[model samples]
Every structure is written in C-alpha cells, then in structure tokens.
Target: MGAAVGAIVIGASAGALDALSVILPALPEGFSLPVIVVVHIPPDKRSVLAELFQAKCRVPVREAEDKEPIVGGTVYFAPPDYHLLVEADKHLSLSSDEPVLFSRPSIDVLFESAADAYGPALIAIVLTGANHDGAKGMRAVVDAGGSGIVQSPEGAFATAMPEAAIAMCPTASVLSLSAIAAYLQEV
Candidate 1:
C-alpha cells in the first residue's frame, strides 16, 4: 500500500547541507511523517552525523541499522559506506553496493528504493549539493506517484543537486530551507 500522508526523503551532498541545523529545529512537534536523510559521508571512517544532528534536532536521531523499523518522530541517517533503503514494510535495509555518483550512501539509491516502497505516499526533497546524484532518483519518486521538492537554487549553497532535480521534474516545489521545513510541518 502507498504511504497515506506521504513521506519526505531528503537527499544531499556535503557542500549543500549546512542549513539543515537551522531548518530542522523549526518543525512542529505534532508533525509525524518520518524523515529519512541521505547525506554523502566519507567511506573510510565512522560518521558522527547522528550525534551532530542530535544537538539541533528536536526529534530523536539515529544512524540506520539493518532491519530496523522506521518510525515517525525519529530522524534516521544512512550509515557511511552503505546504501540505505526503505522496505515496503517500512524497515531499514543497508547495502554495500557500488557507489552511484561516487557515493556509497547515495541519495539516488535511497530515493529510488523509497519511491518503490512508498509509491504515492512518498515525498522526495533534494537539498543543496555539489553533485547531481539526486536528479535521477527524484525523477523516480515523481514517476512512482510521490511528490518531489527541491530547494530553490538561489537559496542553496551548491545549486547543482536541486537544479538537476527541478530540471528533471518540472513540477517539484522549489523553496528555501526554512520554507521547506515549514512545508514539512504541514505534511
């Protein structure tokens, strides 16, 4: 079954991820959609992203583990060196597949899988990034009946990723980071 209210999947590369700290805290407490963030991390080391996000995020934040069930009100980050996928049952699946767009925790892989799992119930968000990794998967989300959002290229630090997403899917909502957070609150 498709997600009933739609889920938001945030995709980004390193350079374009700075504003998340500010945007994350502004979301309302009653908002219950699960947010899965796919940020590119270096493969050679363990990621402190969960810990880092824990400081600013009002919701619980943790690194994704294999077979863990996805729950609302928690933030889940893809562990380094693995591709994170959303199962039809809404559990986490981690894979060591080859990198796409030179990223193991590829945003595209996560978005594509989530699109398949959630169908029209998914909402894909493309954030600031130096690479175009998310474009293809954002398209997949749209193709699968999910809504797609891209941060306004003018507001993004690295416009390539969001630009690519919007270029590929003309219907995506383009907003600033703060606005994106506000929009998520309504979800």
Candidate 2:
C-alpha cells in the first residue's frame, strides 16, 4: 500500500482449482491494472490457462506473449515452458532461460522483473504452491517498495509457497483466499 498499484502479479503451483476459485470473482469487467499470472505446469503440456480463465474471468485474459504491450484491464498468464518477464518499457517478454528451482515459468523471474519495471506501483501475490519458488520473488517485490501479499498458509491447499513467502517477507499481508479476492475487487 506504499503507492497506488498500476499492475498486479500473482504466482502459484498445485493450485489450478484454488486459483480458479479466487480469481473468477476478483476482477470485475473493465477493472483497471494489468494482472500477470504464473501457474506452473509440466513443460510438455500446452497451457490452457488463458483459455480456461478467459472463459470465466470478467476482464480479458490471455497468455503472455513476447514483445506484447501490457494492457490495463487484462490478465496475462505465463505460457508453459517459458519464463515470462516484464521489460523496463512495460512490454511482455518470453525467454527460454534455464529453470529456477526446476521451473521454467518461475514466479521469481516474473516478480523480480515486474518489480524492476513497476517498482512501488506493483502488487505481488503468492498463492498456494508446493515449492518455495515465490519466496524470493515476494521479497524482491517488497524490497522494491511494492506491496506483497501471501495467502494464509492455514487456508492454502499447499502451504509451503505461502509459508516461504511469509518467511521471506514478514511485512507482507497474509490473507485468506476470500480476503485476497475481496481486496482485489475493492482495488
């Protein structure tokens, strides 16, 4: 809450169903702010997240594309097997970089890059996941003076991600999924 957020970035794994539940009603049609998401999937599997969320989300949703301009009122999910990054110019970039923590579309990669681009005007959220991939990323967001939110571990389907994020950034808000969704709606 240090600055008015112009963008939001969220990361999760082992959380497709949980993400769907929290995201569907969180964004109203035409809501401002570009939302970027990364939910890990096997590299060989084609990502259907954009299609899945686009059907249910009120705001426009699509998979992030290389060199694409980040648009307000839209949600862009990281494509599988690629690391999604936000350029200084606020364009989306896809890299076939080495995996971090065994994940190609690393939450850390996106969050850190987005923090560099948006700085204090970014909001980063870490949802349910099985690994510690998002912890360092959430720390980066907070260190950049952006707001960071972590799902309450008690309420998460897989608690490690949120717990690690919380450990990395103690000042981050810890909220239930419902609370997180409500906060998004009110933002």
Candidate 3:
C-alpha cells in the first residue's frame, strides 16, 4: 500500500486564499484523510475560508470548533481569532492564547500539535505566506517523520514562509500550486 496519510495540515498567509482557491478545488470527492488548515487572517475580521472552499471543493469543509472530533474526508479551518490544536486523541481544540508571531490562528500551533498527534501519518504543507510562522512547525513535522511539502518560492506570491520552511527542512518536496493539488490527490 502507499503511505497511509491520516491527516494533512496546511499553513499559509498573505496570498493564501488565492492559493487555496487553486489547491482545494482539486481534491477529489473520495479523499479519505482529514485536512486541517491555518491561514493568517486579521483577528477582528471574520473568516469565510471554509465556506469559500466548501463551495468549490468536493470535500466537506467547515470552521473547526473546539472539542470536535477530527474526522476524515473533511476540510477544517481555524476560526479567525483562536488557535487551532489537535489533541493526542485526535480531537480538535481551540485556544485564545496569545498570538504567536502576531498571528492568532498561528500555523505553527496547529502544525506542531498535529505532528504530535499524528506523527508520521501527517503531511504538512507550507504554502505562500509573507512570514515565517510555519517554518518551525514544518521542521517539527519532519522531526516526527511526517512529510513536508513547501510551495516553490518562485510560485509563491510571498516567499518568506516557504523559503523559511525549505531552509529548515531542505529535503522537503517543493512544488507549484497545481502540483500541490495533484500531490494531494495522490495522498
């Protein structure tokens, strides 16, 4: 059998929505793994990313709620002002804890927690972003034997986050937006 991916965590900032619009729509309806995403948004603004993706993607999508059980074949996005975390038991949690690197729904928090919870079954994707929020978390995912995929800086609208992650995990697979979508289909 191919690698059994239990969960996929994606982190993005800056031009993330445009990137996600391209990526999310490409996942097939039968995708069986859970996808959790953290994209930087202004704390005061409402997030409709889940709804936006849900409309275009085949898989069901929703804003992650605190204490919800993590389920397969669904896409979950962190709420605007809270940090999303994955528990060891595969449950979702939300924290109003102080922002990390000025992002409330910090990508690092979700990626690190998911790495701890899913270990090698996890696949972490660091996409286009203007900041380094997901770099350390991508390293954590790699340390836990999970796969790390970074959007090639040439394709990213903002290169800092992907570049940082690639710097930390030099062996990570680098792909373009459409290639990432295709990779998810394979996973």
Q: What TM-score does structure 3 among the candidates reach?
A: 0.97
lDDT at 26, model 2: 70
lDDT of 2 by residue, 75-185 (tens): 998999999999999999999989999998999999999999999999999999999998999899999899999989998889999999999999999998888888988
Ranking by lDDT: 3, 2, 1
Clashing pairs in 1: none
Residue pairs in steric clash, candidate 2?
Answer: none
Scanning candidate 1 in windows of ten residues, the lowest lDDT window is 14-23
TM-score of each: 0.94, 0.97, 0.97
Model 2 CA deviation exceeding 4 Å by range: none
How does each model score on lDDT?
A: 0.85, 0.90, 0.93
> Candidate 1: deviation at residue 90, Å?
1.2
Candidates 1 and 2, the one with greater TM-score: 2
* TM-score for candidate 1: 0.94
Better of 1 and 3 by TM-score: 3
